[model samples]
Target: MAGPSSFAARRKVKGVQLTIMVVGQSGTGRTTFVNTLCEQPLIQHQQPVAPEEAHLESGIRINPVQVELEEDGVRVSLTVVDTPGFGDQIDNEFTFNEIMGYLERQYDDILAEESRIKRNPRFRDNRVHALLYFITPTGHALRELDIELMRRLAPRVNVIPVIGKADSLTPSELHDFKRRVMEDIEYYSIPIYNFPYDAEEDDEDTIQENSELRALMPFAIVGSEEEVEVNGQPVRARRYPWGIVEVDNPQHSDFQRLRTALLQTHLHDVKEITHDFLYETFRSEKLSRSLVGDSMGAGYGAGQDASVNPEDLATQSVRIKEEQLKREEDKLRELELRTQRELAERRQELLAKEELLRSLEARLADAQHSNSSTPLPPSQPQSPIPQQGQPHPVLTPHGGAPTNGLQ
Candidate 1:
């Protein structure tokens, strides 16, 4: 029952690290929620756009802000990753890729670093423990964009759907909207991080607590950075003409519950699931691909997932490097083999041509020798010799009637 403000006296503890990413379209109270949850202005409000530039597409920006908060007297170092201009663009497909790419890149970084021989002691794990996806308060059902994003990103991160600016809806409207959103999530089979509890293994209190929190799927949140006097007591609230909305008031908003869960009671759970389940799945897939000699594409941007243990990351890094080196070695060996074969083939061709020329030259030389040694064309015809009193007829140069040259 301890809220963020009441955590100072609850329990004292050592340091703990928690990182949460807030993703939602602008104007969904994302900035205000962080400030209200931290009891200070942790994030700067985005500057208002001029009418002239309102229609332009501004790309998504992932900004992580670190803040120190004492939850239940335990010093909690929190990192809030804010996705600004996420859904603000007319073509928001890019933003979706940006976010998903960011998640995958963190995993990929660990994938690469895990295979390194030497571990980088200064390496920091920025993998998101939880992704709080704020559902726009349309006072109706879930938007297609909402369903699509949750469906796609759930596989990569722990997506906890929440309704932002719940003050926009009436009690009845909000009830119906939450129901519809959950229904849509279920229908689409989006694997949101519902508070899961194993009834048999978990204690009774744990089972009850998890069940209760699970029912609050898509927690409604109202956030305000302004403080106002409530019954002579200072309280963080939003000043409205109708009434004031207190940020920490359970009757007013679930902001306090979410803040506590994120930084206090369920903090370790989220991180555990991130490292144990989500990252494991990604690791298995990448290893399988690398096993088959396929590149992991360019998903490993300059980011690291918190899910990877430092030692494991270092080991994996070395393995991956060795694999890459082996592949390169294989390529070089093949190239050398090809060059050698080509050189041998060229030499063979030259030898064959030379042999052919030598054969032709020998034939020519034989012909010349034969011609030089050949009997010259007879200058005069050989006179026929009489054989035993037979008159021999000689071929006459001017063909005198060949009467044996006696006529």
Candidate 2:
């Protein structure tokens, strides 16, 4: 037990808030243990199911009950979460998922609360501080149900194993049973809550206290709500024809030690472990999973259901280059068409020039032919008159000359 020195630190505005979840198969005395711990009827007992309702499947349910506890002059706002029908089903794999999902959902709430732009003032962190897992005392070792349940739940919550209905075994049988259960836990490497301490960092008293508590792992618990008067004092106990089992008796059960640990001595440590290590591990795994999915979705947009493919930067670049190439090809074709038209016009001008030159040559040839035909008018000679002094001469182109003046 911690003295005055331990109470100096650790609390919230409304004192320490601790949420504990109890999970086990039915008939494990879960309801009676809660009532015994709280000293009140915090949970109602399960009634016998009728024939019609028994046939129908009742799934595992998570229900929480609130209570205020004053332990060692400290106010604790405690929430007791009860999980019923955990191992009663024919197929219990789904029940494991149901419990695990509830735990993670509480963590998810805190995660969302952290990411909010405007945080909720009254947001409650329902994350479970510790989980008291009740194992049926079979006078042997841990069954598959016990092993599987604790192994799966150890990571998310602080799993503390307790032997339910511990009074069923004799003292020697109970010791052997606890030994076997601890052995199974070790064999399977289940991370049940054992009081942890640092040898070098923690003081000697702290280390001794924690070691003493750790030695009592898998607490043997017997709970009862009925009171029996012993020595004029009413003590909570369970009655049997053989003898009466006192709930708080150290020789009979470990209820008192477990209660003190939970409510007073180690409450702060349990809450710290849950928040610092367990919940942080879950948060890291969840964020890593989401990041992986988001990375895959970046290139393809909204994953499998996306109707439109997101445009990639490389694809856009390729399309732009193709458009430029098409424009350049169009310009080249237009220039080619212009050059062909100019060449055709030049050919037409050359043909027209050749036609005009041929027409002039034909007209010249016709004048020459007309003059040749008219030259036959013949032998008529022209008389020449001499000039200047006073001589006149006439010339004829015949065998004899003929004078024009005489003609």
Steric clash pairs (candidate 1): 114-313, 114-315, 114-316, 114-317, 115-316, 115-317, 115-318, 116-317, 116-318, 127-306
Query: lDDT score, residue 379, model 2?
Result: 84
lDDT of each: 0.84, 0.85
> Per-residue lDDT for 1-407 in model 1, tens only?
87975685554668788888999998998998888888888899999889998778878999999998877668888899999988876777888898989998988887777778677997777888899999999977888889889888998889998899999888788889889998888998999999888888989998887887887778989987777999999988889899998888887778877877788778999989988999987886566444333333556333434444656656665686688789879979999999999999999999999999999999999999998997767588876667996677755778655665565
lDDT of 1: 0.84
- Worst lDDT 10-window in candidate 1: 288-297
Q: What ranges in model 2 sit over 4 Å off? A: 1-14, 298-407
lDDT (C-alpha) at residue 363 in model 1: 100
Report the lDDT tens digits of candidate 2 across residue range 1-407. Answer: 87665665444335789899999899998999999999999999988999988877799999999999878768888999999888898888999999999999999999889767579999887999899999887898998988999999999999999989999999999989888988999999998888889988999998998887787778999999889997899999988999899999988989999999999889989989988899777765555445444656766343442432334433544554576588779978988999999999999999899999899999999999998888455587776556788546555566566464654
What is the clash count for each candidate, in the order shown? 10, 0
